[model samples]
Target: MEPLALLWDGILAATDPAIFACTILGAVIGLLIGALPGLGPTAGVAIMLPVAAGFGGVAAIACLGGVYYGSMFGGAITSILLGIPGDAPSVMTVIDGYPMAQKGEAGRALGTSVFASFVGGFLGIAGLVALSVPVSRYALAFGPTEMTAMMCFALSLLSVLGGRNAFKGFTALALGLWLGMVGLDPISGLPRYTGGSMNLFDGLDFSIIAVGLFGLTAIFTSLEVNVDKPVAKYTFASLLPRVSDAVQTRWQLLQGSVVGFFVGVLPGVGASAATMISYALAKRLSPTPEKYGTGIVEGVAAPEAANNSASYGSMIPLFTLGIPGSATTAVMMGGLIMVGLQPGPLLFTENPEFVWSVFGSFAIGNLALVFLTLLLTPLLAAALFVPTAYLYPIVIAVIVYGVFAIDASTFNVTLTILAGGAGIILARLDYPAVPLILGLVLGPLLERNIRRTLIQSQGDLLVFVERPIALGLFIATVFVLLIPLFLKLTGRKKIAADEAEV
Candidate 1:
């Protein structure tokens, strides 16, 4: 069937009143979950999986889709307003977003985020609708060798380029990798570093680490640092991005959307990797790269677009090939199964209406999410007005609640607290935490794939070079790692030559 005709069918199917209600309610819940710490889009969707199941397949999918994209917008709330990320995807948003907030442009940051996210979301859905089959088939070409190299390339993009201190960034990445390895070995089924505790059999929950690293760390920092800048009232003009702002960020939005959607199509990568990679890509492409962290609208636009696009891109594989591109989509796959809607090529042939309804829902969900985010901007911005002395306790409480909600485990909460202290120390030392987050997020994929590749090749290093795609990805990873160093060295030499001439 033609893509547009299929999409139109979906639009017709989604006009049912129940689906609309599900989308709206799910968006509301998703926004709330996303604006809170610890419970990211994945956890939010996971927690609501059973409840959404009761709504039936179409309604459940619409609801889950709403939440997925809604949380993408909501993540920017705390990231921009509070210097804390609501979820992992929004971590990049905090780099420039909170600074914009501090500069009394919280509204603009929020607006830019929503707008960019909408653009990304729309593009992602469009791609999914048009190219789902081709993309899924193309992805099938990636074997274990290709996956390992691709994962390495993805991890290298951020860990090498995003931080000022390469050594520190690597250290943080190492720490995250260690954290990812602390539980039982996935292949061996033996405890690696559980320390005789049953709580760690399932590994450290990423949500706990996420909440502790950003939410609790922010609270701890606020408690210790006494900055005297009084909160300023922001007018509507200062809150919204100007037309010029959009014009400036248009390229960034496009770049981020493309990068994110493509990367998100790969299984297990998620929005975290998409956002980090897009941010680095944006910086590399930017004329004013140094201004990224200090606050720039482009910086805010890029990752927001990337992560949203990635979310939509993730659904493509889930629908077409019964593969999940991320943890969030993995949960969504379960929902599909619960509703008796098995994913695969047969789904399009057997349940065309269901397929189209999902695509249509993504379109509607993105539009609705934009409005919800804009409407809630004022209220989210109001959070910035509260004094940190009074506000941080609430944040801490929320962090604890959010962490505890995952698995209902105390060990996870304890890990959160410990991670907070470690985050504070890392921040004080200027070691980047974002790279660590990426490492943790990508670790399983990296490890599992490499192990699988090794097993397939019987420990032959030549396997990496034998395949064309794997070799390309390996070369790309090396290039990504070396380019930054090359640039730094050449830059230093240029400066030295100029000084000597003077």
Candidate 2:
């Protein structure tokens, strides 16, 4: 069956009042979390991850997905109402959104954000519905060789494109790869680096690792430079915009939505990058490029649409390929595993019901997000009033509680703290943790697939290249590796040519 048909079937199953209510609750919770200055969607979902254990798989995931979209909507509130961005993705919104607010057009700015968010989200879902089917269907033919090559291609893209310093990204990835190799070997069922500790049998709990890397990292980072927001008076009247505003940004929304969806689908090109790139594209293409940072609705619409669409884009790989395109989805893989489910091509063939139900949740949550953001925009602005003194402590406490609550072990809590310290150190060194996390998630799969392929070929080293899909993916991996060198050489040549001309 087609992806849309499967999604439609899930929507039918998800229509139960219980699931719908969970979706609403999730959206509300997400909004509150997102409204807070630093607690973006990842933290919102991570802090609430323990509840996934109780809510059951479908309902809990429904809620998490709701929070994902709701937080995107909520992030704009602070960026427009206060000069401070709610999170990284909202940073671009502040450039144009705050200026609009300063000019007494706060409601319009907020309205544009909400409008673009809806459009972008719709386009992204449409992209998911359209693209995921073919990819999943095609992947059903994948053997161990193709799977290994694909994962290698994915890691290369993530390490090379996910951060500014590719070497640092690879270093973090190497750390994760080594860590992944600690447990009993997937092939031999024998321990390699257990250090004789039984706890090493399962290796690291990724959820604990995720919470530490993102949740604890956020909390620890907040301690150093928490800022207080000044009180501001604003009316909700302008949250409803005239039709003219929508009409003006219609093409911009379309452009941003397309850019956001495709940019978002690629692993490691996250929401922040999508928004910034979309904003730049809008500015460069605009006849009124000079008007971008001066508070134009187009500026607000472009990045808001792109980021929200990017959020939707991130979900696609997680559901279809068991590949997380961003950090939040990487964490979400743990949630899926907790439910005794794994994401991938088999999910579609074996667990069609679960797949469709999750799809339905995405639809319901996004629809609710638009309505909830519109109705509660004024109330949510109050989230900014939270003092850093109170908020930071509460967040720290919540991080500890969340880790322990889900893990139910003091050892996990200690590990979380240790992981947080590591994350902080990595951050200080300008190394990204996303690639590390991706490596951790993909490492085991890469190892398992390679072993399977090798065993099938009786240890033939030429097996990887013998397969066409694997060969193509390996070529792509080589290209990704060479990109930096190619760019460097191009830069040197450009400089030399310029010097000669001068």
Candidate 3:
């Protein structure tokens, strides 16, 4: 069957009233969860996974995918109104969005966000529909050596692109790798890092770690900063921007969507990185660059669009390779596995309806998110008035519930608290949690592939470099690592020369 026909059939199936209703319910739940501080898409999905598991594959995926996109849209709500980012990707939105709120243009800022989100999200889904089959076929040819090289390349690129400090990113990555080494050895049956603890046999739960790192840590950080201050409120009659506003932002939205989609396709380069890079690039190329952080409509549009596009883009790798591109994608991946559907090349061909249903549902969910956001912004804004003391505790309760709900294990809850504490300390020391999460997600894959390659090659290490695809990936990894160092050296020399001249 042709891919186009398969996609059309999937869309028709997804648009069936039963599936559409499930998608709407999932989006509504996700939106509310994402609009609240400390509750990101990852946590939202984790909390809902068990419920999704009870349903069939199509319904399960529709609900999970809807939650994913809905959170992408709803995250901007708190970022704009409360200056508290609802998700890591929404952090950039707070820069321009909060400023607009402060200037009494909250409604317009939100309007721009919704429109940009729709554009980016719709484009991203289109890209996914157009690209997933090709990408999956390409991925199918990759053996253990090629897969290992690809993982190395992804980790290298992510470490370089992470933030100002490469060392910190590596530190986080290494910590995650070490944590991943726990439990039984992949090749040998011996346990290396379990330290004789029976509870460690299953390894640390990724969902627990995620809840602790993003959810609990965020709560602690909020409390430590200033939970006493009341959030300011602003009112506007409409949340819809003028047609001219959309026209003015067309270029920024386009560039951001494209950039976001590509980044999202890469494992470890998720929505946060895409949104931040897009916003920075948009500002750099804007005619009025100086007005960026001052609440310009384009400012909100660029990041919102980039983030939403990236959210959909990340799903490509997840569905194609079983490699999640971000924390939220990791949750989705886990949800799929829990529901007895393994994600990868076989998934696309064997479960074409499920794949297409997820893709089509993203398109529908984004539209629902737009309407829901328009209707709920006024109510969401009122949530800002809820005291942080009250809000924080509720958030904490939710995080606890979310953690336990995943596996219903007390050990998981304990692990979550420990991971949360570790996350808080890591954040204070400028270490990123994303790399750690990425490492945890990719660690098992990396180990399994390495052992498989060694076994296939009869312990010959040369097999990794012998293949063209693996060799190319290795070269790319080297370049990704070296370019940053070269750029830093050049920048330092220029700075030194300018200082000497002055």
What C-alpha lDDT values do all the predictions have? 0.77, 0.83, 0.81
Query: Of the candidates shown, which would achieve the greatest lDDT relative to the real structure?
Result: 2
Comparing 1 with 2 on lDDT, the higher-scoring candidate is 2
Residue 15 error, candidate 3, Å: 4.6
Please provide, for model 2 over 1-502, each residue's C-alpha lDDT reduced to its tens digit, 9 standing for 90 to 100. 5667777877887888878888888898888777777668887777667665458868878888887778888888888888777778889999899999888888889889988988898889888888777788888899889989988988888899888988998998898888878888876789878889887788988877877787777767755544465534556677876589899998889999999988888888889999999999999999989998999999999999998899888887888888888878887787888778988888878887887797788887887787799898777776555666787777668667767776578888898888888988998999988888888888888898988998899999999998898999999999999998899899999999999999
Q: How many backbone clashes does candidate 2 have?
A: 1
In order of appearance, the predictions have TM-scores of 0.65, 0.95, 0.89
TM-score of 1: 0.65
lDDT (Cα, tens digit) per residue for candidate 1, span 1-502: 6788878778778878999889888887788657765457865675566567678978999998888888888888878777778888999999999898888787788888888988999899888887875754576677778867866775676567546777786788788788889888998899978899988888876656665675566556545433233433456656555789899999999999999999888654578889999999999988889999988899999999998999988887677655455557755766687688766556776887887897887788788887777777666546445576686565466556655654577887798789888988998999977667657756776788789989988999899899998899899888877877898999999999999999
Off by over 4 Å in 3: 1-4, 15-22, 37-39, 46-56, 82-85, 91-104, 224-237, 280-294, 392-395, 405-408
Say which candidate scores most in TM-score.
Answer: 2
**Higher-lDDT candidate among 1 and 3?**
3
* Model 1 misplaced regions, further than 4 Å: 1-120, 128-132, 218-361, 386-399
Candidate 2 matches the true fold with a TM-score of 0.95
Task: Write the residue-wise lDDT of candidate 3 on 1-502 in tens digits.
Answer: 4666766777788888878888888888778767776666876676565566556577777888887888888889888877888777899999999998888888788889889999999899888888899989988898889889988987886676765688888888888888888888766778778889988877776666776776677667655443233454645555876688899999999998999998888766678889989999999998889999988888989998898888888888889988777777877776687677878888988887788877777777888888887888777666645778787787577667756666687877898889889988998898878778878878888999999999989999999899999999999999988877899999999999999999
